[model samples]
Target: MLVRGKADRASRPNLLGDLDIPSGLSASVGISEFTYRKGQEVYSENDPAEYVYQVRKGAVRRYKLLSDGRRQIGAFHLSGDIFGLENALVHRLSAEAVVETSVRLFKRQSLENGAETDANVFHRLLSMTTKNLRHAEDHMLLLGRKSSVEKVAAFLLEMDGRLTSAGLLSLPMGRRDIADYLGLTLETVSRAVNQLQREAVLKFIGKTHREIVILDRLRLSSFDIPG
Candidate 1:
């Protein structure tokens, strides 16, 4: 189980907390929750997009498999974050648990029906869709234009904001996951992180690569490519 600090209480997972669920439809929507083991598939690419999911605990990684069988990770969804809200009928990427994860699932058909009769539900759907679009746009820029060091820098800064607790950042994914997400080789990602550690920009916690402490946030940010 994940341990959270007092400062993280406001961001803790609460099903429907970020969503505007219409009152009358709440009982009829067929909402259910399930747990997925670490590295287990939540859904595969091209699967019918029959449900929307929100992370209640742990983390999820969404990725696409190319024809050559190479994997490209798109994004990581943390606790309280909603995902699988694709516009297409089929999922464009597959999702898997980075750790043992719990998620709340909503039947997409039920949600669509609710949106048809409720303005609030419709607006909420639009807002969630827009948020996903903005993330995708930023990811595209990071992958296509940023240098290797810049990509790694931006990634560290992102995780620092999302998963840091008491000034220590714990990464749920491995170096390979980070490499795929940044469109770089695993060695390159490791090199970038080691360089940061040597420069005193960040320091590793314990002997694990997954835990880090940022020592110089300003110096780290300086390496990130500007928008």
Candidate 2:
């Protein structure tokens, strides 16, 4: 269940952090904020694409169910990241809160209406679409061509760039989630992470290995290669 924030739109910092929506365009729409507990379902697959969301805090995972009853995670949306943006009528993947997450959302129609008359808004929307496409292309290569270590290295580098805080890369998802995202088995992912640690590329911090500190970023990047 979505627990909508009581604050009005005017009190919010920005309408769309990724889109950097114009103040005028944002004022015309009613943005609703909601908080979801860890493991809460945000939306199911094939649901009507009524809204687009921006992460205010915490993270979300978007995934699809495979034929053999396996879950394939397509993407992980971190703080300030956008999700559920769609040009189609329905969502392709189901979304769930990876942790206690807060998100701001607005109807998709508001953006559509704004884009019709505003070239700037239209361009921003196009840019976002292109970004998602690029990510999809990269993921395809990672899953099909990369080795287990390479996949884990690539994932660490990605989290380092996106959500690393105070020199520590604190990952929200677990081994199972990482395995699904990287198209690897849980043991493979675990071994890869341990290998990186043994090689002195990264050190596991905190009570769990999810809290990591990259000791040698260049070495980690070298493992990722083009994929």
lDDT of 1 at 225: 57
Instruction: Sum up the clashes in candidate 2.
Output: 0
Superposed Cα deviation of residue 81, candidate 2 (Å): 0.9
TM-scores for all predictions? 0.91, 0.92
List model 1 lDDT by residue over 6-30, tens digit each: 3344554544544577667778777
Residue by residue across 147-227, what tens digits does model 2's lDDT show?
A: 899998888888899988899889999999999999989999999999999999999887767899999999998998864
For candidate 2, the 10 contiguous residues with the lowest summed lDDT are: 11-20
Q: List the lowest-lDDT window of 10 residues for candidate 1.
A: 1-10
RMSD after Cα superposition, model 2? 2.1
Look at candidate 1 and give me any clashing residue pairs: none
